[model samples]
Target: MLAHIGGRGFPPDEAAERAWATALWERTGGRPSGAPVARQIDAIRASGDRTAELRRITAPTLVVHGDRDLLVHPSGGRATAAAIPGARHVEIAGMGHHLAPGVLDRLVDLTTALARTHGARPATTPTPTPAPAPPTEEPA
Candidate 1:
């Protein structure tokens, strides 16, 4: 089912498959469900104009889209990035809805680099621990 939906990036490595399967199972109790057809139709109809909302996002945004994604077309990603102010768009070649095993590190690197470039600082100091409270003296 994942393969049919995800298209080109299906049949991920065994470890990834197991991990994702476990996560999905835990999240949904293995009884996967999607929005109702009516709701989906309504959402599609209402999604026509979101430029104003997109423009209001002030935080640093990274829009990473896979060229081969079948669930959501690549143009949607492009449009999202274009609408958001200063949103960096990255279109990975040959990637689909599901990322290839090798692409994980690249995605992480891209995210880290973007955060660094946008002046987002990583936590340098460890959280200070509080000292233990002194024991109360027992009255005789």
Candidate 2:
């Protein structure tokens, strides 16, 4: 499962892989658990083609995929972008299905730029209403 999600050249660091495996093992009560992994595989298999629905999307869409992604190939991203109207596709080189160091920041920046370009406004906190003016004291 890790290999499928992380790609063949994933981790790039044996220590990182060991740490991840240890954490996963701890999370799974130290027993070799395959339920979650099986579920992910099943989900992928069950997901039917949604190209028609994808083409119907009118909102500004961004399809970002790792060029080295093994689970979902870059072609999938290209096809998704092609299907959506005016969708932008970004292929990051040397990245895989798993999040690599510093990739999240790049993704955030890309999304932020896209949102800015598309005039997406950040949620604003509503200004608090001023307290009702204290009742004026009656003149003697």
Candidate 3:
């Protein structure tokens, strides 16, 4: 999982990877299981092309992909965006299959922009404010 997340031009973030690993361990009760992952991969492989179906989608679509993604090449994203009529494609730099440190914020911004463009209103619930930055210590 770490290898897949960090490879393909994305530098390894040890802290983030360790946190993710811990989360996964907690979720699965520390059981060594490859069946689920294998099944997902097999299912993806078994699914045939759906270009015609993709083209039939009428809703506004946004395709965001990492240019450096090794799991699925950027060309696949390009092809998907091309198939969907009026689908906007955004290629992010220095990202892989998994979300890196700064990618989440960028994704959120892109999603918000797309939603606003499509006349979607923001949720009524108040958004959480970020914590104040720590004061820098001065050198004596």
Candidate 4:
């Protein structure tokens, strides 16, 4: 998924404020005196703390979290999966707070592995029941 970060989840508060102000200025065709998307920007800033909401995801998922991700935090990724019914979590050994170039490949590989293991089930067949035989003439 394409990320347009503006704080930790988006960018830092200052950067988000600045970026939003700049974008609003640009999009408004230079309306130099305006609210400057302040409310929208504040909402974006508040979205960084979404651990509880993420846990509610019920779809099958594979999470690859960087051990060094200060922004999102490693525990968040772990908590996300644990909250979901059957979600899987994968921690990358050398990943950082954010994905570097080609980081998607690692995620893809992780999800692929999860899908393979999750989709595969042991072969199961019911054992056949033998019919009862007639009683022998043992009594005299």
Most TM-score-accurate candidate = 3
Against the true structure, candidate 2 has what lDDT?
Answer: 0.83
Clashing pairs in 2: none
TM-score of model number 1: 0.68
Off-target runs (Cα >4 Å) in candidate 3 are 1-13, 125-140
Residue pairs in steric clash, candidate 4? 5-10, 6-10, 6-11, 7-10, 7-11, 7-12, 8-11, 69-97
Model 4 C-alpha lDDT per residue in residues 33-139, reported as the tens digit of each score: 53545876788798886757776787678877876575577887898777776788887765656454446577777867776776855469989899899888987
Look at candidate 1 and give me any clashing residue pairs.
Answer: none
Model 1 C-alpha lDDT per residue in residues 104-129, reported as the tens digit of each score: 88799999999999898987998889
Query: How much RMSD separates candidate 2 from the native structure?
Result: 5.4
Cα RMSD (Å) per model?
4.7, 5.4, 14.0, 16.1
Candidates' C-alpha lDDT: 0.83, 0.83, 0.85, 0.66
Better of 3 and 4 by lDDT: 3
Ranking by TM-score: 3, 2, 1, 4
The alpha-carbon lDDT assigned to residue 80 of candidate 2 equals 92
TM-score of each: 0.68, 0.73, 0.77, 0.45
Tens-digit per-residue lDDT, 53-133, candidate 3:
999988999998988788899999999999999999999987878776667788899988989999998679889999999
Query: Each model's number of backbone clashes?
Result: 0, 0, 0, 8
